[model samples]
Target chain A: MSLSLNQWTTRRWSVAEAVDGCVRHGLQAVGLWRQNVAEQGLAESVKLVREAGLRVSSLCRGGFLTTGSAESLDDNRRAVDEAAELEAACLVLVVGGLPGVTPGEPLGSFSRDLGGARERVAESLAVLAPYAGERGVKLAIEPLHPMYCADRAVVSTLGQALDIAERLPAEQVGVVVDTFHVWWDPQVFEQIARAGERVFSYQVCDYLHPLPADVLLGRGMMGDGVIDFAPITRAVLAAGYAGDVEVEIFNADVWAADPDEVVATMKERYASVCGF
Target chain B: MSLSLNQWTTRRWSVAEAVDGCVRHGLQAVGLWRQNVAEQGLAESVKLVREAGLRVSSLCRGGFLTTGSAESLDDNRRAVDEAAELEAACLVLVVGGLPGVTPGEPLGSFSRDLGGARERVAESLAVLAPYAGERGVKLAIEPLHPMYCADRAVVSTLGQALDIAERLPAEQVGVVVDTFHVWWDPQVFEQIARAGERVFSYQVCDYLHPLPADVLLGRGMMGDGVIDFAPITRAVLAAGYAGDVEVEIFNADVWAADPDEVVATMKERYASVCGF
Candidate 1:
């Protein structure tokens, strides 16, 4: 399959099981998350995927630089280490939002310093880039949808991500062009072209509105939502991005389905919608 | 008060009651919605607000041209007529997204043709601009947050909105800069500056994440959420936007509050947070 199954797309599946499933389904790549790797012992997880004849497409995340503190930087370094040890293509960063609030904080307690949060992300990236380069793991900053700007990633556009990525070596720092987060952007195609060879990972998922009860879990499967995969996929290809196209959905209904069935459906949808 | 109370901020109140509430709170202006205008006879609604000494700052809506149908264009023309009859400063256009689906359509059934929808908006605007110009009503295209791009407005940035407005006479077509819909934008200040005299309306509200179940009703009152109002308010003022600053919240809790109390709170928040 031209698509790689991102671990979060099937959150219930174990690392070994996911790799085995990918092998059985003829998917050559898998995008694994940190927590899943920790669950099976990072070393063991790496060996299992490699033994299964699968490539680790990208690590799920390693950024929460909203705080821009030593501890946050250290955690990100460890994430880079993990990505390097697993021989993944890049360590995806969900560069977090404003500082001084925990996840699920009450609406009233939210911070108003978006500019400060964004600056901190740049500072943290500056500190981590050299470390990631040394470890031979590319840092892929993912620009999430603007809806996630308050509580999740402050980076909300591919152009914004490229702005940060351009400050570092292209091979060391890159951007992830996730369709679900960026499909609405008017300048998406132009920005993707600007990304060119610095495009580290190409993630696909569909955007469905009237979002589910929890908006974060509202990503729809490809072909089931409003995004046209062909144009975006073509853009990525034109940008010279030959990376695995990872399907990373976070939906309640998708997670509830049988794991194998979900893989089969994803493969079918990716093939039909992406023309892969 | 420099702040105008948008009709949806206290949605439960009738037109007379809202105007009375504004009068009682010493508010000089109001942002009226079409439904509320329709609730009372259009002429009566105009007479009532004028008698109460309240200026109708802007009409709530008039563009869902994403469908590009004759019916949609005609409806928008009528909205222009309503705004002119009411003597509103401008008619705010939501500029609906994608085609072939009605509002509140199941998320999975969304249309994927965003580029086409946006082109249709430009075409319809070209049609409506002259009509709105003749009526002395400025068509203010409100660029909704990108999250709303699937079902609401496809124009997701001030730059995108201006791109549409600049196609015609600046007096007939302008853009509404709503803080809630645009707080996360990286180029907000630059775009606002570019807007200059074409900024037809300045709307204020705060963005709170962990959105309420009904995301549409998630807008918070000025000081209660994550937005830093001073900078944005300053930017709008600098852009030569001398129009009434409207406080347009859609929170369920705010709606349930006593209309008088809500107006009082809006006045307080606008003064303290927006420095108005």
Candidate 2:
């Protein structure tokens, strides 16, 4: 019912400090990343959030069948296990693209077998969904911005994600509505309606710059980009998702500023722009 | 119908050189950008093409709604005028995005109001379509890669485009299906089926790199990227689009190479990959 700070928003802060900072900022919850938990030690990090009286909204850090890596499948399953251990609502996966790491320089004569990459993602998710669901964690398939389709996530359109979701039982699979990736989709509202109550979590970030190749770190803070938040919020609410609002951003400039000040500004902006 | 080399395929060539190169490579047709046409002098360029005995398959562009700039609107209309002057088959319209110069810098606010842009584009087209149609030129709504929604064209999906096309009598408006834009779309085949008979032109390009900024120049060559051209071609052919197969690529690297070599290779690759 309250806001959650996706520690990604305040990247400079340790996961512990991020949780502490969220507590300080009156964010009722927080979403932890696997690396953040690992860096701060999962137990201590969990304790830190508890001590600060915060909720772990959701745990990202899983999925990405980039190039059909079986090792990636195992790694993602571990992420599912870790998310369960963290007692998060869902494990958000930024499904992978293409096979192999070194698709190498000058995609010179490169074959963007996106269809193959997509098949691998679906296959991996099919493999992992039951595990995550069995552990009482929903798999929140966050369809990324279309710009990330080539390298980050092939799941570009929310409609496309909904199609994927309809493939899985509503109770077993769900989607995380992230404004940054989906705001541009023409069928966004209609898709959101389709996603309906299966909307497990919602994320907000603005497109600060043209989509970057290094998409993970170039995220913009809400209100700083061209995403109309109220419509998205209305759709999420209409879809019957009453989860904590998570401010998940990864902007370098936002992180470079004082973390405390960033939180204050984000809180104020969220209220001003999104009315949290 | 023979394949056309969208001069962009031999960007290194002058207008005359592109014509010479395409003719030398036995490519019977070509698409010319209005800017280059302006540089080459429209009359002289038309004469040169006539002398070369090549089909002026399509004009490279006739839209830039993103700027919302009167200047851009005027310029685009002029582009339409030029397309008409050149006696091109169609004035390819890459509808512009938000009213700004920075194409990649998606405005911090999501403009879900594509309806407005669509209206504006339609308004512009309403003015230009008559003129274009009068000149025996068709308006080809080349739905760009969705990545261009914010900066280039709000008209991303082919379905959306066909919806726009439905607004006019079918003959007045049509689509220029470029494989690179809609290749990854899950609904591409279905949409192509839906786009039947009205397809004015079809292009083929691949996506070697992830869909990111610096896009215009980053397009891959035919058969080089993961495009299922055979199926798409079958769909287009089934749709009754009997036209020149244009090879439109925007790779800076490829363009920086020898124009002669690029054309020869394109012909060979197109023949081998997609066939005639």
Residue A233 deviation, candidate 1, in Å? 0.4
lDDT of 2: 0.77
Q: DockQ for model 2? A: 0.43
lDDT of 2 at A173: 78
True-structure RMSD, every candidate: 1.5, 3.0
Ten-residue stretch with the least lDDT total in model 2 chain B: B101-110
After superposing candidate 1 on the true structure, give the runs of residues whose Cα lies further than 4 Å from its correct spot. Answer: A107-110, B107-110
DockQ of each: 0.71, 0.43
True contacts kept of 1: 0.71
Query: Which docking class does model 2 fall in?
Result: acceptable
lDDT of 2 at B214: 65
Error of 1 at B75 (Å): 1.1
Q: Per-residue lDDT of B92-133 in model 2, one digit per residue for the tens?
A: 888877555257554544454555776787667666667666
Alpha-carbon lDDT, every model: 0.89, 0.77
Model 1 over residues A1-276: C-alpha lDDT tens digits?
268999889889999989989998999999999999999999899899989988999998899998898999999989999999999999999998777555466764456788889988998999999999999999999999998888889999998899988999998999999999999999999999999999999999987766777888879888777888889999999999988999999999999999899999999898889763
